[model samples]
Target: MPTLAHQQIHPHPHNKSAFAKHVILLLSTMMAGVLQASSATDQHYPIDVQSCDRIVTFDHAPKATVSNDVNLTEMMLALKLQDSMVGFTGVSGWKTLDPTLRNGIGELPELSPKYPSKEVLLGADADFYFAGWNYGMRVGGGVTPDTLDPLGIKVYELTESCIHIMDKPKVSMNDLYNDLLNLGRIFNVESRANTLVTGYKKELADFQAHLTPLPSPTKVFVYDSGEEQPFTSGRYGMPTALIEAAGGKNITDDVKKSWTQIGWESVIDRAPDVIIIVNYGDVTAQQKINFLRSNPAFSDIPAVKNNQFTVLEYVEATPGPRNIEAIKHLAKAFRAAL
Candidate 1:
């Protein structure tokens, strides 16, 4: 037997060919792995998402986008999909976000303080728009799904705002979860979405279990806006569901719409035991309270007289992950008021 060094240095002709074949086999195996990884990254294409009457198909995940309002923007950030976002707007309740979320959001570009104009949205060259009813695109604003779809852009509306168009009987947490799962499917993050939904469900169940139900549901009124005529959440809105889930009754439950403006007399006649003021826009919650306290019309109201008021941020009242927290907060307030 020859020494091992001599055999490798002075290999036979046949041995040389065999060594080359082995090298080629190794390279081929490595190439196959690279291809497999590329395929995995390309999976979940041609996904169809149903938004009300429209079935929008996404050939690939949106790379650039314009997201509107705190609700949709926060949802995208919670999914850890900030790279997909190009610009965002509507920062009404952004201060209430967790520090981590706030830091993540701070890195993104703020396209506008409010809803972006169609020109601004188009200028961003975004492929998708995440928004809600009247929060972003408005009728005749020239940025709707009909207008954007023709330009190769897709739009997804918040499910809570689509009850009227989708014929949903009432708002539920399922709507928020469905939207999260749908976005996950669209973005190929089903596992993350499932985990988030599971966590929220567990937390909500725990909150409900510990809640002490009132002898009678507290008659609650949701004050959103409109000083001339009070604008409140109706039976179809997320606020109504939150109120009911928190062991309180929404006085506007009879109104079959989302948010409606009713005369002051209706609110007076209803005589809500507790008032939930929505904090948003130019009108502060303190201003609303002052208005209620100073006005002779509201003097007779039990909530105003007894000072049973709970203030919820505009984002909390919307359909999002925060809704569960809103329920817990309201439930605590209801228990305290009793």
Candidate 2:
């Protein structure tokens, strides 16, 4: 017949110990859950990503994003971030979108046919910009990081293209891997990015393992564009990395430039065993090949003489998802030429 309040404060003797233990266990479980949630939250947000020489920090995944160029845009798509993108720029100005790329982009408007101004991005309400030096943002251009940052837009520079604005190590396929992983982190898609990169590494290794050791590496040239002098991929270009991985040597490896116009004389002097023509822009790949085949200047080049010209799309030549397939094509072509 004890009052209800008295029973609540002090249960029967036998039940008191049991009630205390129950209360302790309940509180302990609640505390552990709170601690676990805090750990997860700390690990994911406020991520810091290295963009060229700069470190950009993010508090949350960007809701509105824009990318430039087919290669960089393709990287975003590869991470399945299309839903976050408002639009893209830097295609159709110089390069045509192939069916695969065209479809990957779906209905996203081409914000600009070429490099867009800061106003264009701000108009789209973009929170993130994925581009690299000269790929979309030129040095001192209207759309540079400095110009856009004040507008609340963050930028992520392409690793391969960073050589344009900052001193970087020699180019490698790792450049491609880094971009994918870092983008994955920025967009909160780290798990997908890690898995894709792992598969790429294994695929590249498996292909290289099957390559027969050659007496000497095949001398290769990457022809991007330029009728006046021939814009070729040099030591720091992604094609150079691809060439090396395919068991071939880039004849321009000594040029000390990434992608630049070199004298046809330099190309003639080195005498490439194979020429990888980048397919893009106003001219067709065949026209580029025809130019080489018909020209007396290149008649004596080994690749020209043997008709060893291999065609790779602009996407394949640059750092992108197609790099592995491009390398495979090059390796087969190199051996066939040999």
Candidate 3:
């Protein structure tokens, strides 16, 4: 038997070129396989996203854009599409972000502490705008979809905030999941979206399984702000759904509105067992707590009397990926209080 080296050295003269051509073809086939695999890994583009009654087709994943508010910005980061964001605004809630999300957003440019002016947004030449109604961009602010769409900029509204413009209003986990799925589709990250939603569902199921059934739901009141008239989440708000998922009942669930300002007397009458204080803006959760503790009108309330309060960031209270964690935190708090 000839050695491998001897066989190569003593190859038939007529077969030398044929053997070389065969090697070349084999190499080319391997390279083609590698190239095809790489192409398959790339995101699919030209996605059509129908959200909030508007259909916007993304020819490709947006590469330059401005995202407003914590909810939208965080969603983009969670989807790993932060590279598409040219700039963003609304950093007041940045402190409340998940550490990984905070680090990811830390490198991005912040256009403003609040909503950016139309001039700034337009100047950025962003192809897309991820924002909410009053939360990120207000109507008549000169940055609405009607205005931006004409300028070749597409705007996607935060699902929770759509309650303001939609004919009917309600909040559910599906709202957050839909936003994530739609955003994933737009950016061609549907697999990531599915994985994220699956993880959330599993975590929710585990949490629910361990929960001890209560004779009746624990009454919860969500305090956002306002001293004269307290701002609370109603049936149509994300916080309401979160509270329910945590095995607590939103005392204001009967109110058809989203976030509504109600008389303190109304809150006093219901006397929630737990108070979820929204942490955001210049007003700290401590500030809200102090106001509740100082207010004589609230002294008799069960939540105030027992100091059964859970602090949720304004971002968590909104419809987004963080809502699952918010529900988990609330459930733990409710269990501990009971």
Candidate 4:
């Protein structure tokens, strides 16, 4: 065979025109993509969204926002909204900040180590507060919507926590998506938010598909904190949805509460095969595990007898980007029979 440099080669006239047309088509497609990307950031201004019972109107995108808690902050960071934020609150109070979260904040300060007081938020001059009831606010707490609105700070309540102040159905992953979608529209980053939500849904579905089916859905109990009475997640808590997604049942689902106390008798009656420990605060996870191990009351419980327990960090068990990975861990633990 002759080398190209030593041989004469000629393209047909139609072929040359076809190649030119292909180049023009490719360039036009590229230009269209560029225009679409730019348009994604365009805002109409004065958008209204129904968040829980409140009809929140955004005259303009908030310039200084503060997200409370580690998991909630992770959601904001996932959307790349860090530059628009003033800082965060509620991370250092109960749990230490891990390196991944610490670096995501970069130079941003932790405005308050615990639940920030209204004055702390005011001092930061935050124009928006990304928080939930009990996550960062109480039913009538000092840092609630009633207090923040007059201070010119817009509040978006986490959907899962809505059950605390209002009547709502059981928690689902859609609650997580709704939060991101609303935040996207509020920030004029709707395209980014939609893309992230879509990716998450697809990723979660894919994760569930690969999971080997157990003999049945594994029974799961979420042990948050308790010594005398157990404080745990119930029907409306994010863990209910997470446990269901991992092909397990949350034993506390019948309680009809979020993070609340339940009778120790109910826990013993349910007898979960697996116990998920939410690790945080002054009390160590091992200590909590040992408590269950040594207690004569729990001696007959299935999980206690088998010592089948998994630990999730405070952030992993809450609503955020980490939940999917947490589900994978849960599925493996739930289906360990294989």
Model 3: per-residue Cα lDDT over 1-338, one tens digit each = 98875776455888999888888998999999999866754546566787677787787777787888777777887888877889888765444444665787767777777777777777888888888877677767777888888788888887777767775557888888888888888777789999988888898989889878766789999999988888888988999889999899999999988788988888899999999999977789999999999988899999999999999987789877688899989988887777
What's the lDDT for residue 144 in model 2?
Answer: 83
Clashes of 2: 0
Per-prediction TM-score to the true structure, in the order listed: 0.87, 0.87, 0.86, 0.87
What residue pairs are clashing in model 2? none
Please identify model 2 stretches exceeding 4 Å from their true place. Answer: 1-42
Instruction: Please identify which of the two predictions, 3 or 4, would achieve the higher lDDT against the true structure.
Output: 4
Sort every candidate by lDDT, greatest first. 2, 4, 1, 3
The root-mean-square deviation over C-alpha atoms between each candidate and the true structure, in angstroms, is 6.1, 7.9, 5.3, 7.8
Candidate 1: how many backbone clashes? 0
TM-score of 2: 0.87
Using lDDT as the measure, the top candidate is 2
TM-score of decoy 4: 0.87
Q: After aligning candidate 2 to the native by TM-score, how far in Å is the CA of 260 from where it should be?
A: 0.5
Q: How high is the CA lDDT of each candidate model? A: 0.83, 0.91, 0.83, 0.90
Clashes in each model (backbone N, CA, C under 3 Å)?
A: 0, 0, 0, 0
Model 1, position 94: C-alpha lDDT score? 38
User: Candidate 4: where are CA atoms >4 Å away?
Assistant: 1-43
lDDT tens per residue, model 2, 182-219? 99999888999999999999999999998887779999
Per-residue accuracy of model 4 over 209-236 as CA lDDT, tens digit each:
8878887888888999989998899999
lDDT by residue (tens digit), candidate 1, 4-51? 646755557879988888869989999999998778767767778988
